[model samples]
Target: MTTISTVDATKFKHVSYLWDDAKAAALAGDEVALFIYRSNMLGADLRLTNYGGGNTSVKLKDVDPLTGQETDIMWIKGSGGDIGTLKKSGCAALYVDRLRSLENVYRGIEFEDEMVALFNHCIFDLDSKAPSIDTPLHGFLPFAHIDHLHPDAAIAIAAAKDGQKITEELFNGEIGWVGWQRPGFDLGLQLRACLEEAAAKGIKLRGIMLGSHGLFTWGDTAYESYINTLEVIEKCAEYLESNYGKSRPVFGGAKIDSLPEADRKLQAAKVAPILRGFCSSERQMIGHFTDDVRVLEFINSNDLEKLAPLGTSCPDHFLRTKISPLVLELAPSEDLSDVAGIKAKLTPAFEAYRAMYTEYYNTCKHDNSPAMRDPNPVVILYPGVGMFTFAKDKTTARLASEYYINAVNVMKGAEAVSEYTSLPRQEAFDIEYWLLEEAKLQRMPKPKALSGRVALVTGSAGGIGKAIAKKFAEEGACVIINDINEERLDGAKAEFVQIFGKDAVASTLLNVTDAASTEQALDNACLAFGGVDIVINNAGISISKSIADHSLEEWDRLYDILVKGQFIVSKAGIEVMRKQGFGGDIVNIVSKNAVVAGPNNPGYGSAKAAQAHLTRLMAAELGADKIRVNTVNPDAVISDSNIWAGGWAEGRAKAYGITVAELPAYYAKRTLLNEIILPVDIANACFAFVGGLLGKSTGNALNVDGGVAMGFYR
Candidate 1:
């Protein structure tokens, strides 16, 4: 049998005691502010709890809006709020008296769900957000301040087979225990009964270890409660460390060695898109890949087959990662470089996982249960590589991976001391399909048009390219902004990070005319966001010269950047999109000159005409793969334009027999609509083509030239 070694005490000791007396004193009179401070402190550490997994509360006397009298009110972390980023507005304030009175209406365990709806009537503040199901758990407790957390170390003890005995020995009766039950009115009642039973025996209970659930700690003051929570978790860690001193191997030692770091990442990049496609069987999913040492150790271990099948013990872990991960059925000595072989093996494994999930749903479902959700696995484990998680967006996918890492920690701790246990299959099903949980899922806002998609925009450091990238980011697509200019690319990246967050944007220096540079850029996109679904071929250069004056060098440079650039980028990007096994979009940023004939513009106009025709040719060829190719032609977009800034404005003015300052007016006057074109106008046209509105239409060009008569498709 495989066995685990003791935990390093130093690992737990690293969770610092960060409470500052001066900071606490600064908010002495405001109990809610104090509560927020305490919550923030605990949530700032993932060792304490995973993101959005814990709840905290402070019972205080506040003026009741309806009665105009001071009454006891409980302010608890509300539904769908993270304690780490919590605000006063994120809390649910409820009347304690009204909450306690609900015990009279509580029928039994079967009807506990009914209590959730009644909680709205107990609202002390009309503006309060809806209460989480855990509200009753906090409100029923008598403590002035309370915290319920799913710390990895604490859940380790809670998930162990001998958890009750370990709890008694470690806390010496200070912390009590309750059997596993789903969080609701019934479990809240169980908690109160456990505390009362301990008190009747003359035991001073400081906290309670929930069976296969989490830990609860409370105190008369906010700081005291924070300290209590920390103390209990630290004690649990110390106990585990003492029982099993680091002497034996973790997870029964490694069955297979991990690949080299670079090789592992390459393997991950190669397989991520295939895994993403399978996981997105129900709906499109964004992907996150991690080669964290902890994950690699577990997946490479002999106990992986034994432990991973049991699933995660914590609700937060399983809810995000699903009951169990889909483990690839590959041999320890198998070569990972064969991506096609891996794909062939994954297809059957994926189907089996789906079958298993369907069986789980059908066996455990009840009449009132929400319909079965996507049966595809959220987490996929590769032995030599690491972990891959997919979700509706990048952040969620990343969070799922983090939660699974937490689960790995819990499993290590539990197995080190005693046998590890997971929540029963039926219980897991009930929680996953709970009506309240389904309602919460339904309450989520509709996803933006470009949600879950990743886009790569060339020449995105400024002007039309940047505008298009920004618009894609606004619609919830992760964007990789590219340009040959390092300074402008960095500036644009920083600006995007500030507005859309770092996770939503990435930047790379790309010379689209070079095949190797284009391939490397696409590879960077795959590493950053799994794969690229939208390719914007917007990079260009201009040379305004007549047939007699045009130099061969200048003509070749124009075609190299304007025509061949789009072809190279499209070719490389299509390879990635094909590997992803999903359809994608390719938008060519051609010019109005592609259709309109003009003098002194032979080099620029001819190259653009080639780009326009290339769009149609690729659209026709790639339609079998479901990749759409389209064109957006804009005329005289002088604002923030790289081409205009690079002397194209002066050349155009000279051609039109006008001053350089009159170029914008000159171009607008020649248009049928006489409207000045802007970068955002071009961006909107790009969005219209790929934003699902024109999803069925492709191999077409929409001119954004304010209706130039000569540029019209005749």
Candidate 2:
């Protein structure tokens, strides 16, 4: 038996006090100003934590000088305040004793009510901000100064399958693992129960593991607790790096030599987008586990389900990695870059996973059923092709991928210990089918502009194309979304119905540039929803060209799609919009070049001009027919929208002589209103023009350009 000795206090006692000069100064200042400073500090460190990933609090010890009676006047981190840019109001001050008392009767209580009760018992002289979900977790720690962190290394270790054992070895007997569960008061209650049990058993439990969630460490002093927590995580990371952190293996589970060169190159290109998609969401965890042997092995594994044993790392991760990866058995004659074929192969697998997940949920409970999550894996690691993460939002997708990477390593280590003791299938089913989580999955908190409307967006495959299509879908509109990128198109198809329900969505892969293809796509839309009401002419591309140096063929090709393609689709859609009787919307997505002159944009600008004028002419003709036509002129929407163009970060960087870091002000300041418009911003405008609000608006060009082109607007 190994008996641990208390270390010399000197080694861990570098700074016993919680607040140093800087922190104290900030805390002493006006509450609002202090919060702002704290928030910025928190924002700067990816490891200390990411936004909403952790919590912090200050215990105001109030003492009557005459009586010497001291009481804890609590100021806790507010619910939803990003610690990096914390505000004074961001911290909710609840009476410490009331919070402790609430814990005694908090079983099965609703989360929101529990929070309200905490706010009601406030003692601090500050506006009551809703307390953080981890308020109870904060309350559980009996400290004057407390802080919690979801440090990258902490998550990286927590993601491991044998997390408890690894955490024990790294943090030793000083830490406790609370198993996996949802966050909020329930988690707080769980942690308290564990602490009470430890006390009864004559065992001391300090830090805690919230299972797949993160970690919590507290102390009487802020700096002491913060550094101690950091040290514990750094040590755990060091431990893993020393032992189980093996060399990242090359992707060699399958023979890529059989694949064609073009296909291989395509797959290589696809790898970055998938990886980027994952990392983009959680930038704080940059380069943490981009390449891991277990991740690679799991990607290459025949039994891929083992990689995602207990579903996604959390809800945000689910958005990126989806439900599972698509496993493909490369045939002798198959071409790897046969993008369409690869998509076809994966479709059935995705459907199968969906079916299995649905069945698992249905069978687990005889009393109630929950809505199903999107039938997609947030972390899809495609063997030799590497991995891809998907999410409705960029930040979440990246975090999901990180979680997946961490989870894969943990599972690998745990398997080495024994068959990894995963939650039972029934338990897994219960989580997957949890009613509250299901509600979040099914409910949209706010109504979308195009809600209840049906739209058909052509070229809804990838980049700007997919963003627009998704924008419409997100606004509660059932979309007949089309795209040439069949794999992505199909993936979106599966997700749209999963998110919006089967009755609200339909998808097909068709090239809008082809007249016949446009006609067929329009027909599909009409067939799916009984009629098509809104048509977003988003199927266009740019050829980097100057008229002086560009070939005639390239110039003609740009016109073929940009101008001619819009004509074909809009013409076809008008027939359906008329038949539907409800006045329809036609939004021609044109570039800033249509109004603002720029060099080397001859083809793109000219084609867009034609489309813009066509919009006016169509509006004039379609107006009496009760159909509205408008132009959505957007200035450089920073996204994967512009084809193989570098990407949002690159474009913003190039435009302002700075990296994506300086882009908020750099891009925004350039605009008259200093607005850096996003794709969603443009989509909402388009929805307005097409929906009831703009039913009376027509024949006008709406600049969704964030005041970048004021002169052209009038």
Candidate 3:
């Protein structure tokens, strides 16, 4: 059954191809650089290509150093290359002649690994990165440069029922159409045949339109290929917008007739956390929402579940996003006006969604098939609330969100000209469970231990605290940098945001001893991310004094900042974790003096000891909730501390009858390891505790003092 959308191609100006820039760079004789520049120029536009979803190649001249022979190798963007920042290292140089060896072989229903091994075997340089799965398509083409991408506009038209006929009419024989097939041996041979067939018919081929997959554009120069890509894509965009669209929603949902925009966005936020819980994998889920008018409208469309069943807009997205999003049956907005109300109403809906997913898998699986994937829903559509996406980690959650937003946009665009035509259920299964895609997943590096977790590090404005926060970020955790010093806190936030990116870092001013301040900070952290999973107790200050000389104020301050503050923060954090229904971690930073006190530091030592004991009690109590509590006690780290930077170090050194600079050496010489215990050492111990290295460890203390004689643990 075919349907028609009244939008037709109207004259829209061509977005000029970056030919001038490419020409200038090529004239300077840097062809490889030209390839990267052209690829990035196209890739930077999300409408043209998505993250990690495109490949580009250029034929580079190579001189054999050992044989003095001249040959050519095509340096193509490799498997893991992200073209946005692609450079020389992102490419794999494959010998063109070696790649031709597997051209005509008959592959009879083979595994994707065999083809991948063949591609790996054809590498011209021993140390070059592995070629991408689509390398053969680029190599077989004689053009000097090739660009392949899954542009939404191009794919929207390619997935329409009038696909090939409309493509021929639009490009006027400039683009060749290749029907959908899993990318491998057969696709490569057919790609070459498609171009040859077009050329033999006296047609000038500019690019290849892959049915239900993507597009491939080629040229004698990088500029020509990149420009052809932009021109054809622009053509598709104009055709959809000018002819069929009466007026598209900002993204692709039906406009909410009853709710105001603010109310709709509010409703989406209220529903986000509930869905996050329902869609969580082994790790808790992170939810991201977008009420792009189009998406909001799409979800509000009459019978959204029926419409969403149209399947993935493009096959490239099948792995990250399943064939169709799980559209939960939402209740009326008035019944679920608040967050708590919505969560309660949606609880049963989530259970039903999972049950259906299991049923779908059972019906789809063969006896020899692999086990079903995690039953958690990755994509969800709801009425009035827009679309929400979930994943085990924040970045994946964000990607899933944007992917669906674009998908809805593309599906609507296709509908503007013709109905959204999708792949058959079996075809979707073939791609989703395809050995090649699975192999790609197997080859990927394991995610960081804390990849999806949220960590809040107190006193992170400097030294030990900053190091711990950095370690968490490196392990893929979203970190919150908390501190009391405004200047230092802002500076640390800027540096962390620069290093780890915007969403991965957040900052808050927290006075650990104040209950209201602690609660406020926790609220902000929860608001930024749906919940807090890990909290680090690192803020402390100590004054050197004899027990008799210690003032009441000095004792109170030590206890307040070091002990009471932790209790306040922990109380607030535990509440959030319990509400989220996931276990968490609390790491307290104590001192070696907790076990072995030095003279004149009675107040500081006692406070630390109390903090350590408190850690044990919390660990024992919270274990049932899945929250782990631990402590890292270190000897003097004055050389690696922000707290010790002022009068404390000077006063301590004076008491020892030595200069302040000699304090680090004094501590180092007393330790058996004779090492300067840096802040990172403490951070590593904390990682061992909360980073899942010692999952069985709780109610324990790890000494990171480099084996101090007095601080030695049995």
Cα-based lDDT at residue 185, candidate 2: 71
Q: Is 2 or 3 the stronger prediction by lDDT? A: 3
lDDT by candidate, in order shown = 0.88, 0.60, 0.77
| Residue-level lDDT for 675 in candidate 3 | 87
Question: What would the per-residue lDDT of candidate 3 be over residues 400-468, giving only the tens digit for each residue?
Answer: 777776677677667777667777776777667766667667887888889778888889889899999
lDDT of 1 by residue, 431-455 (tens): 8888888988998999999999999
lDDT (10s digit) by residue, model 2, range 324-387:
4444444424453444455456556556755775665566763765544454444544454444
Error of 1 at 68 (Å): 4.5
Worst 10 residues of 1 by lDDT: 1-10
Query: Which candidate has the highest TM-score of all?
Result: 1
Candidate 2 lDDT (Cα, whole model)? 0.60
Choose 1 or 2, whichever is better by TM-score.
1
Error of 1 at 587 (Å): 0.6
Candidate 3 lDDT: 0.77
Clashes of each: 0, 31, 11
Which number leads on lDDT? Answer: 1
Report the poorest 10 consecutive residues by lDDT, candidate 2: 280-289
